[model samples]
Target: KAVALQKLTYLSSLHFAPVASHPLAFPAIELIASPQLPHRRLAYLAASLSLHPASLSLLPLATHQLHKDLSPSTSSAANHHVTALALQLLASPAAAAAPDLPVHLAHDLVPHLSRGSPRAIAAAARVIAASPSAAVPVLFKPLAACLASPDPRASAAAAAAFCELSAPPADAAPFLPLAPDLYNLLTTSRSNWALIKVLKVFARLAPLESRLAARIVDPVCQLLARSAAMSLTFECIRTVLTALPAHDAAVRLAIGKAKEFLAAEDDPNLRYLGLLALGMLGPAYASTLHECRGVIAQSLGDADSNICREALHLMMGLIDDSNVTDIAGMLVSHASKSDPEFANDILGAVLSACGRNVYELVSDFDWYVSLLTDMGRNLHCAQGDEIGRQLVDVGLRVQDARPELVHSSRTLLIDPALLGNHLLCPVLSAAAWVSGEYVNFTKDPVELVEALLQPRISLLPMSVRAVYIQAVLKVITFCCNLYVERLSDSSKEVSVALNGLSMDQTVSGGSDAPIGSSNGQITVPRMMEKDPFSLKSVVHMIN
Candidate 1:
């Protein structure tokens, strides 16, 4: 069996998930209760792998052996390894997943968290997390003392234990007393890992106790300035960004550190983390973000997508009333040159920013409308639904913007090339609807009619084609109304011209014919020729 341990280990690795009825289950159980030490260890290893935590019925079989292994060795035979393995089993998915740990085992388990072994302490914390009532009165003080232990291993393990306790924040009020201990570890412990865990706990704890924030701010700043470990530095920056925003000095220091992260071009991890940290800053520190816009812009093209995404996120934050026009332009431009996926990401971010709160950041609706149109024309543009919604929404909500909206819509609808792009179908539909609904705003209704009736529109889905046809009808109606109004005006002008002069004057002018059609208004045959919805083009397209 000793020589076969490797085979057993390999076999254990094969079944990653637990199976209650695994063939080796019963042998492993008996091996756990065996007098031989090697058998017990191997049995524990095998059981840990295949034992489902929900198998409470099997508890009777192995509980006694586990309790015996976990219990303090009475003589010189104390094997910390056996005790460690027992704690791990209990801490793992097995007892960790247990809803209510058997109360009897709490006696042996509580001592491990206090002072037994570093490995044991951390594992005990995980197991006790399932039954937290066991930790406060019995193990909390000893665990806190371990955080102050000179050995970094003990302190880190204790910090890990506290990290678990300080989660969800509401339940974390119990760990408020550990803040002074966490702060000590934060300042004195050279272990970056321990410091990170302590910072994490503080991130949750700082809000619960405001005074702890003020007290920990100085040490956190020192760590930010002094620590070369980007992970630890980023944690300190996060602590400041999330928990201590009111402390302006620390926030500035944190933001400065974040900029350094952004500037780490060689390390994409640092760049991504830097962007993440900067994104947490509020508008009050926009100037800092603005100053680092160059680095942020550079991040948008980073080889790593996480960096790109975070870069995009922070870039969107920089958009406001004053700079949105510039920012939107830059993003849309960048999107065009990018691959399709990131291109859409850029388009979406700008759309959300400019369209947020009903385009709250947009002052010049005309410019924004044109921007939407340009985006719709982008080669990789697939943000048609959003673009379409905003287009039609602008036409509906802002009467003054309709003229520009119609102009932009005309640009999109006229492109027969765009009709085949199913992604752009929504955009084209919106364009058609906008052009027709705001036909009065259109300077050239005939051109709009031509665009709406383009033959390639057959490539559009039925729903979109219906919208296109309806738009054509609206354009026709608008043109008809305009023609009638102009006709009435021309007729009135002719009447005035004839009455204003004598018959001889009319006869001398131009063979005694009325000059109404020649005056300047659109005439019938000319209108028909220019209109694509006219009889000839419509018939040709139908045929």
Candidate 2:
């Protein structure tokens, strides 16, 4: 019978699901009624492996036998192994999914948990959690009591269960009373795994109670200091970063440990995790994150994509009104050098950071406008739509930015090479719009008109072509108006101003300077110029 049960178990493992036609399915279910304990346990295993959730109801006989073995009056129940087999069967995911399992077996399950049966604790916790109305009143006390159990097995199992229970999406507030017991475990337990679980629970709980952070800080720090285990150290680092920031001493220790994680040159995962831990620090810890800039920047070019991504996230987090220009320059340069996928990710991150909250971090519109044009010009650049929107958006929202935006727009408009790239079309369209909207800002409008009408613009979508045509009309209108305004004086000067304009407008654009000094002196910078478009007018570009 044992040999036959083993064969059945082997067959069950072959198929993820069994049909009614399978040879082993019904026989495995019948074997659950076997008198021999080994036969019963193996039969349960076969049935569990073979059966699908929908067919769980076929287990009425198996369920009845399980109840019999679990009953205290039964001679088998007195045998710990027999009781463990019954608990294992009852706790199996297939059985636990059954709506009636908890209803029929929960009363029997609670005692094993109360007595600190290690296996029973994990399985029963799972079963209790699955119940629609968790038998919280009947089950929680025993479960929490297991934390205080003298046996390490019971304590570890209980801590793991509570860690899961108190995790996010499951409110930890209800488990607050368990904190005292968890604290005891934290202070005394030598088991690294158990301590990690307890730390998880405390991490969530600390945010809920102001005083809890004070209680757990010292022990977590001691663990951080004494433990050689990377996992435990990371958990402590996370607890500090997430919930115990007020402890300056602990936070500094965590940051020091995180830098050690970054220092692991051969292990990409540790480096990635190090960046993740550091990223969790709030604005107050910006200096610590900034101090790791050299290591983080090096990570951007690492062979591992995960480390690169984390590095990019931390880099974006470091930006503000003060360093946005320099950081934006570094990212744009890096994007140009990366493969297509990571390049686009870098571009997207920078665009999001600078553009977040209506360019709140942007202090110099000139520099930002230049950065936008530089990003649009990358060969692998696929972020055209957003770049286009930001260009037009900045022009509309920032009055002082119109001149720089116009210069940037003219830079894009005149690029015959860029007009061929479908990816650059959105940027071109935005440029045309900006050039048209703020034609007065251009160094020269006549040259702007000729560039807008460049032949390669035929490669543009009809929508973008429409934009080019509109920009051409705007430039013409501006020239006619400016010319007429000048005609009242000297048509020759107007013609000379129009003639110097560079019809082959330069694609180079970007600047961090304001358009004009406080004394109203103009300071034109790269990527765009301040001139009206005509050969001589455009030819004499602003410096």
Candidate 3:
């Protein structure tokens, strides 16, 4: 009786007695103090643990004597007070921890929660959230009954409490048949707040619980397609993405349609959310890259920089094992022509694709080399250093490009006697770990060592000699580690060796011997067991 509580001043003012012993003292004090706010104060007091037992002893009499006399108008306020007191009581640690208390407290709990204002209803939800098991099927009944109540507040509160109680449990699957009711609320009323809250609760429930994902995906997709409540659509997108990973094939199949649907969407907000959701669905659907590629490519040219950034991020996720080469080609084409920000995005993507072993991207060697040089001069100026550094690493992994790299850096690293100097510097540091799985381009160690040892070449300035030696070591290591086949459809015995030596076991010259040269001058050198250039001769090469 909030009305009575509001009317009784003395009842509202009674604070919890400090002494635990005076159970009988509160009733006499409440009787004298009961008037309007004082009654609310007393109800607040009676709700406290120290005074709980004493107040409970008198509640039966008070409910019968005082509450019965209240008219319907007064009953509403009285019910509010009673509901508040009930919630406060349940929240007490003493009541919760009492070992002898029966688990089924919902019989008494239902009426208090089902009646009263939103505050009381929300308080009841908190108590249920605190201890859900003790208030289940019983709480559900009146909550369902109140959902149809004439009072909007009662219906709203009932919806809130029902959502909390029905939140998915690890031990119990959410009863899916009830979804229609929730969906009805979301669709029938423009109560976006209530709908959003309910949807969130549904989303929070574990994904593995039956067909919940399917149920939400269709309805949400409709909302998204119609551009109804864009934020809710975004939330639905997030919820579906999160849940679809656990869905059966039928669900994934249905979810796949969202990409096609979103591709046609004109609303930037929905399109943005769609791209994100599609990106999140990446590994499961490689075709998504191709599907979104047009949109993503278009976004790169968008007036807004954030659109470009997001498009690049999506491109990174959607690029696949099969289509990566095409993607890299696209990136490199941009870089080669000096497209401003796009060249930078492609450079970063190339490095990432290479580092992560997205082999399809590695086939565009010509473009790859050009991008490397472009990035080499400008990577430092870019926003992300790690991306810049990774670009350099990709550059170092290039076997076919070593000659180009050396040629470009000739003034700095490839001078005649400068083999031992830091020709590649930090690039070589990354090169030290790069594998030769795909390309073989390194110079023969024996040839490099011999070139360095020649008296005329060795006599150059120390700085020049040091540079040669560094080049010799880098070349030798590169040749030694060569693993990927060098020859492609373009040529035979052409070893585009990376990180290792290229022997080209099959000779391009038709035979492994000198070509028809039985002349006295031409000769084949014999293999030496101790030759550092020999495959078995190097011991951890530099190490």
Best by TM-score: 1
**Candidate 3 C-alpha lDDT tens digits along 371-452:** 4544444422242344335534445566665554433332222234332323223332222222122113334444434444
10 residues in a row with least lDDT, candidate 3: 430-439
Off by over 4 Å in 3: 1-109, 134-172, 175-177, 183-187, 197-227, 232-271, 280-291, 300-309, 329-350, 357-361, 364-373, 380-425, 428-543
Tens digit of per-residue lDDT, candidate 2, span 1-543: 557657656655565444334555676777777777777777768765654565666757567766766666655443556667777765667655565665567777677887798777776676667773756766788888999999998999999988877777888889999999999999999999999999999999999999999988888999999899999999999999999988899999999999999999888888988999999888788888889998889899999998899999899888888888888899999999999999999999999999888889988988999999999989889999999999988888889988888888877877788977899889998999988878777776667777877677778899998988887777677765664475458766444334323232222214522343234332223322333532223223222
Off by over 4 Å in 2: 1-31, 34-62, 72-86, 89-96, 132-134, 209-211, 444-450, 480-485, 488-543
Q: Write the per-residue lDDT of candidate 1 for residues 187-247, one digit (tens) a residue.
A: 7888889999999999888888888989999999999998888888999999999999999
Task: Say which prediction, candidate 2 or candidate 3, comes out ahead on TM-score.
Answer: 2
TM-score, model 3 to reference: 0.48
* Each model's backbone clash number: 0, 28, 58
Report the alpha-carbon TM-score of model 2 versus the true structure: 0.79
RMSD (CA, angstroms), candidate 3: 14.5
Quote the positional error of residue 44 for candidate 2 in Å. Answer: 3.6
Error of 3 at 51 (Å): 20
What TM-score do all the candidates reach, one by one? 0.84, 0.79, 0.48
Computed on alpha carbons, the lDDT of every model, listed in order, comes to 0.75, 0.79, 0.49
